[model samples]
Target: MSLEPKKSILNLEAYKPNFGASNLKKIIRLSANENALGYSPRIDKELKIGGFNRYPPQHSEELIKTISKIKNLDQNKIILGNGSDDLITVIAQTFLKPGDEAIYTEYGFLQFPQSITVAGGIKKIAKDINFHASVDNILKLITDKTRLIFLANANNPTGTFISKSEVYRLINNIPENVLLVYDAAYAEYIRNDKYTDGSELVEKYNNVIMLRTFSKLHGLAGLRLGWGYGNSKLINYLMAVRGPFSVNSMAIEAGIIAMKDIDFQNHCFDFNLKSMKHMEIELEQLDIKFINSSTNFILINLLDKDKFSAKNAVLFFKNNGVLVREMNVYNLPSHIRVSLGTEEENKYFLKLLKKFIRKNDS
Candidate 1:
């Protein structure tokens, strides 16, 4: 036998991360949609004072309890991961096999297709109507070989959300033999009453599994703590495949404390609420098209300037010490994604953007 990795591994393009700690101080970094408030102070205390020598729980026992209380689901249904990305991979590992198929919206998170490939499976791209993923379109993509349907709420790059009624209809029509994975990593950012994080459906449908993370609202992105909740039957299967101690010891200690820090979570939520409103007001005056978002980030469709796409504008921002996400890889070269930031950072970015747009006209 040849000394080589799996053929699938050779074909896969690894997920690219944009910012690192060193690059952080050099630019504004609105690319990742990371919480601008930074880590919870409690996370800081836990890191310096929390013990790192011990082996953390392989599955989240207590952390799931809080999530159970928050989501109103039984604790037995949850499985933990290093991050929601890991949870996504775990789903592929458990459910998808060689020659099986996974379906996702055309503009879903980049990791969805990558995860399916990592499991030696093929990915089928379904269409999205405008910014929202069309559930009906996804239904049409299902075949006898399709084992999974991966969905991103308030979808990546576009930052658009599917309505709750549409979600309910999709799950009802979906075949019981197929698994549906709800990747709601940005679920915490939504304030709408109509929004259902798929918790109710997960209760009603054994085929559905939902994933969440401590990265966004809790400001624990660096810690990499994330989890999935579904029926105990599904959770057990994931646990069997997931590596032991995949979630770090320090992250568990930090997570327990961070979950209890409700005050900090609310503060971050309110901050995003204010920043999103203000940024929308500023963008409106420019008369540029944008997607309506109910998440922490927004899709900005910039006015074309001298044959320049939004991808070019992103590099311009980077050159000027600001950073934002370019969506060319997501098949969205005409747009960019920006996370809500601090009052000062938002003002600085707006000033720079206005100057760039103005110069193009002059």
Candidate 2:
């Protein structure tokens, strides 16, 4: 007889990540939303010093201290993860039980639902308005069985986020029994005055967990390093379930250096602001509709969905040696998502975008 897994496990589809081919140097990759500027140069010094033979520090203490200092969070309440996805899994496993429900927005990160299902919890999706997470809609979906709520601030694919007031409303209304998972992977890229990663909320409420990653602005994606801040009790439970040394020494070292490299961080922040504004102007000139993004990526819609669809745009870009994310997986068939690359890369992508539009003019 065949070995059988749980029904939920059997029903789950494998996650298809956008890891570019080995010939990545020849391709302009805007599919994964990774930082194009790369990690802080200070990491090279640490890598040369060497510490590969020994096991990583227990709970990554030094790394935690560095993160705590930067975030102004308590060291005891912080936990490092292999990546933000790792912490998401930890949250799901620690808080959810069989037959419990977890809520996420319709266009939120795909990991939220996958993590919930792996923990044998029901996935409940709340509708979004204009590709933005609707606070009212999410609240309406909540029930006594709802064990967790995953909200991706400056959410992926759509690159749209709710205001601080909206986030406050959601938190104030949510029951104390339901844990809030605020995924802030792209938080560093946002410069909006009205935005918060919900870190302050984590300090105020035992039910909140704020997740951040070194993968985006820090450009340490290859290291797969991330950290979460929450109440001491919640963090202790998450750490209990996490494997000792899930975070490697190299990642920890890289994260520490990256966190301290304020100059590089500021450079990337400035570049993104300038490049995004330039792209926005170009898009407006070409009559291409796109989200007013606060994150490092933009979601562009092709109004002629029937003829010049998102799939066609993806193919056209690929043929031109540029790669953009096709949004069909996110149920955005009319839209394509592209990450802001360096200035030259942005110009090249914009040039090809114009060429594609001209070709499709009918």
Candidate 3:
């Protein structure tokens, strides 16, 4: 017999990131929800790496300690991964058995399905209300087989979020056997008073794991550092499944400095808020419909799909040396997700977008 991969792995769709005009001399990339202001300058000055010859700490102890101090969490209850994506996959592997079901909203992060399917779990989708993760709908999808629920607060692509009350409602309703994988990659960007990042729930509930990443606010995407906080028992299970030395020394060193760089983090947050607001106003003035964002990115909704579909808009932007996320992967064929960029980058993107609109009109 010919060698073949598992059927579940065969059925999985690869995650595609927006790689805009890499060959271009200068391309404004606002596709991936990356930190526009870039990473902390303190990382450059303060980060030290001495042991290149040996394997890094298996548990990323120092990094975890730093995160624990900053977030006031139990270090024993925290687990580090190569990135949040790695943690997600480990969660699926540790929890899901063959034919088990995991629920996520319609527009949830694509990694949820990928991880679940890879772990031989059935993927269940709850319909979102107006691109928002609806608590009631997610609860309705529960069954004897459901083992995990993946929810991204200040969700990517749509950039919409549910409040703390709604999150609690979901938590209170879901069977304790079912683990809620709360992905809070964008938590650093949220200024809303209602958002919780779901860390507190992890403390109270044994079945909940709150996932976080330094990729976004800390501008450590390239380094691929992320972490999860949950009950000690749950964290222990994840740590058992997590690869030894998954987190490298450079990432650990950088993460420690990045976590402590409060000034740099605030700067990124402030800049994102201001730039996003400016872009929102500009989109309104141009009569372009877009979602009100709670995170660093805005979702530009091209309502009249026949005239200005996301596919066409993405092509236009790419041609004009501007890269933005086309949302067809999330089944949002008429929308594009634009990450907040530097002032000049934002202006250039708007200008090109305006020009694209004019061209479409003409």
Candidate that beats the other on TM-score, 2 or 3, i.e. the better one: 3
Point out the higher-scoring one by lDDT: 1 or 2: 2
Q: Judged by TM-score, which candidate is best? A: 3
> What would the per-residue lDDT of candidate 1 be over residues 1-362, giving only the tens digit for each residue?
77888878986677886662433456787888788898679767665454667777777677778777866788988888999999899899899999999999999998899999999998899998887899989999999999999998867767778878988888888889899998888888887877777777788999999888898888888889998889999989999988888998777778888877888988888888888888898888876677887777888887444455887788778877788888878877878888877788889889988887886667
Would you list the C-alpha lDDT of every candidate in the order shown?
A: 0.84, 0.88, 0.89
lDDT of 2 by residue, 61-106 (tens): 7778888898788998898999999999989999889999999999
Steric clashes per prediction? 0, 0, 0
Q: What is the lDDT of residue 171 in candidate 2?
A: 94
Encode model 3's per-residue lDDT on 1-362: one tens digit a residue.
98889888875678888875466788888898888788999888887868799999998778889999998988999999999999999999999999999999898888988999999999999999988999999998999999999999978777899999999999999888999999999999886788899989987888889999999989999999999999998888898999988998999999999999999999988888889889989998988888898888888888653488888888888888888998877777889989888999899998988888888888
What TM-score does candidate 2 reach? Answer: 0.96
lDDT, candidate 1, equals 0.84
Roughly what TM-score does model 1 have, to 2 decimal places? 0.95
Worst 10 residues of 1 by lDDT: 17-26
- Residue 190, model 3: Cα distance from true site in angstroms: 1.5
Q: Using Cα atoms with residue i matched to residue i, what is each candidate's TM-score against the true structure?
A: 0.95, 0.96, 0.97
Q: Note the residue pairs that clash in candidate 3.
A: none
